[model samples]
Target: MLKIQEIREIIKLIDQSSINEFTFEQDGSKIKMKKQSQEVETVVRNVVAAPPVEVVSTQPQPVPTQQPVQEASAPKTEETKADTSNLHKITSPMVGTFYAASSPEAGNYVSVGSKVTNDTVVCIVEAMKLFNEIEAEVKGEIVEILAENGQLVEYGQPLFLVKPE
Candidate 1:
């Protein structure tokens, strides 16, 4: 049987690494940990003729769950350090992979100097295998692209900077 402390330590190590899954087995006990949506899900099993059970630990609380991408908080960056009072930031509504274009062969949703209205589809953020079209809620001209294509963006992370119209 694995001790709670040992399990917690293993979780800590896995949490710090980028590996999505980790598994261990010895004797008749087995443990599997998988990461999903930034939170770790653990499954324990026993090969012996015994009922499998779940062990809960309070040391490492799961991070708050995130909702689907939508407009979120915009953090200040180097570009914002400049006099950007007249600028508007297009922030990610959820955590996902940011894509500048709809597909490899398609044109980017928006580019620097591109004029956009409040309803313009500025980019697509892929979350949970679903492509979410992100809209520019404010009229502006694209001034900068803060996130790279195929980059993992966090909730409220600035994806673009625009000079307000």
Candidate 2:
């Protein structure tokens, strides 16, 4: 196993150099680091699972009784659905937490009515501590943002709707 100081030095050297990826293996342990051209860096590690915990809720749940209200909104829902039926969906490439911006202080990459090109980065998805940038694959204006910031998204789930130009 590499000592703490040695590991720190290796990380410093990798950061100073232009290498995109570095890997080292000794015995049964492995270490890998990857640097993104967009300034994202990820350190991959093995994770161990902990025992599960059981929780019991005692709070009473409220029952919903809004059938009439739902019926009244059905037509409006259908109309809204029909309007977006022609828009293209930008689906997630992997399961991860969706982020509207690179950082909390940063502005959102895209919002409703925002224009995007094929290579435009629309959002960031974080899975296993690695932040993956998701791009807009079509040239269009964003019609909707389906996922909320920090919300967990599943693979192939639609994240945005875009009206193609």
Candidate 3:
């Protein structure tokens, strides 16, 4: 791990250099420092689950057959809100990963057309290893779930659209 003094030195070096950003990675720790117009931004993330790399292969290999699933729903969610402005939206209060259930094996807290009270927990948002239960403050039936399961949601991003009864 890099020391605080080392980080300070790096920041000082970045300030002196012509480069606007600096990034370094060692083992599983990654650090990114960027200079914005108003301030300096620093982001850090640790990824610890990598297998050991020992052998080098010279032969050409075929690409993996499994395809990645990308969620193309953010724009559609915006369109949905625009189309139905009468509905009440349950937006996220913080940036986190949206989860429909408490656990992977559990049922979703709320689904489309599901009746909900003001105190109902409609979803869970996990931020920095903490799971936060999100509530539906409006008394209504859930009309649409704007975010997909396990999707990353930003602050004020709509999670559910509800139609008041």
Candidate 4:
């Protein structure tokens, strides 16, 4: 069981950060918390069980309705409207640090309105111990560069938005 103060502190932290998820473990118990929009949900799964019951003679009780509980715990999904025609995004193939140029002193591989061929090296992503040069898959003019230089990026994260020729 968590103290009320601890639960309040976790809620405070969630309100102060951009992180949508948090988990804490202590004293053989774990609590997972998530916040979405204006709602917060917490699930506590205890590892230990209470003592088993002895022989009982009481009559069975009616089960409570679970519809409200389910409604309260449902996850919310946010939708964004995007124009897909004429707009194609270049995504990172692997999780790594994105570099806009070969080095800090070098010119960027591609910029807005830069014409690119299929084999043009658009950027480099450093993964593990190697720096992999990312090439343009389609001949086009770059309309946008989504990722910043020397930024950590996740797999499938959008790196550039291109308008195909």
Candidate 5:
């Protein structure tokens, strides 16, 4: 069971974090919370326009033509998505700070191109002062490291992309 102070602390931390939802259960007690999404409306108002320029020429002037402006498209991540579609994604089990190494003085547990077994410890996620070791869960070579050391990671966020054997 969690005390009121502990619950309040958790709520404050969650409110300052990017986590959209969080759930915890222990000792037959459960707590779930979700943040409401807020949409911001932006209004642009100004009475400003360049006055039309008047040009006088003796020779016939070429007709001024307006070219269509192409809207910029969003960057494509589909290629990368397709490439990793067959890979196994290792995700964080709980919201916490992700650490690539056990400590600042220690080397990283795993890196890109590192091979790992299902039981291999890949990283650590610290939550509520508890350091939880995360495992690969699948035998594969790490193709990508998604989270940075000391970065706040949300529950179920992808921490690594592995190419399964």
Candidate 6:
């Protein structure tokens, strides 16, 4: 488990560093963190593994006992439904690896709450060994960032959410 202080430190580093993406692997766990650009939108994929269960009885359980299990799964279904409609997506113009900054040593083009105009260079998508600058098509304030830096982004994949100004 990550400590609160460590998480805070990570956030601070992200705020201060020019690099937009960072990944760390420790113990048996891995974490990838990225700062999104103002004009781009991103999609987050979460895969949760089911917890291990111990069987106390070899016999089949009664129908009545399964009622609680069915009820518990309902919340997960509702959460998925809630997330479906709450997004404003910014899609990629090409297939490539999404980058928030020009390079690992450079500052990111944008961050959450950043303002952008129609011509703002929001991010760089590397395709066929070439770096392509992605621009915002509309003026807005960045509300959410969707993709992680250095991650493979498909064509038309969302990169950011912008609240129109």
Off by over 4 Å in 2: 1-76
Candidate 2 least-lDDT 10 residues: 52-61
lDDT of 2 by residue, 54-129 (tens): 2221222233244463464356667788988889999999877799999999999999999999999999999768
Find the candidate with the highest lDDT and give its number. 1
lDDT of each: 0.82, 0.76, 0.77, 0.75, 0.76, 0.67
User: Backbone clash tally for model 1?
Assistant: 3
Instruction: Tell me the lDDT of model 5 at 116.
Output: 100
Model 3 ranges with Cα > 4 A deviation: 2-30, 34-83
How much is 143 displaced in model 4, in angstroms?
0.1
Off by over 4 Å in 6: 1-88
Each prediction's TM-score versus the true structure: 0.57, 0.55, 0.56, 0.51, 0.59, 0.49
TM-score head-to-head 4 vs 6, winner: 4
Instruction: Give one digit per residue, the lDDT tens place, for model 5 in 25-52.
Output: 6754456666554421111122236443
Name the regions of candidate 4 deviating beyond 4 angstroms: 1-84
Please state the error at residue 15 of candidate 3 in Å. Answer: 24
Error of 5 at 91 (Å): 0.6
Per-residue alpha-carbon lDDT of model 1 for 45-89, expressed as tens digits? 777876776553333446655554433435667775775767898
For 14-58, candidate 3 gives per-residue lDDT tens digits of 554345787889978777877765455666666677653332212
What are the C-alpha RMSDs, in order, of all predicted structures?
10.8, 14.5, 12.4, 14.2, 19.3, 17.9
Off by over 4 Å in 1: 1-80
Leading candidate by TM-score: 5
TM value for model 5: 0.59
Model 2 TM-score, all chains together: 0.55
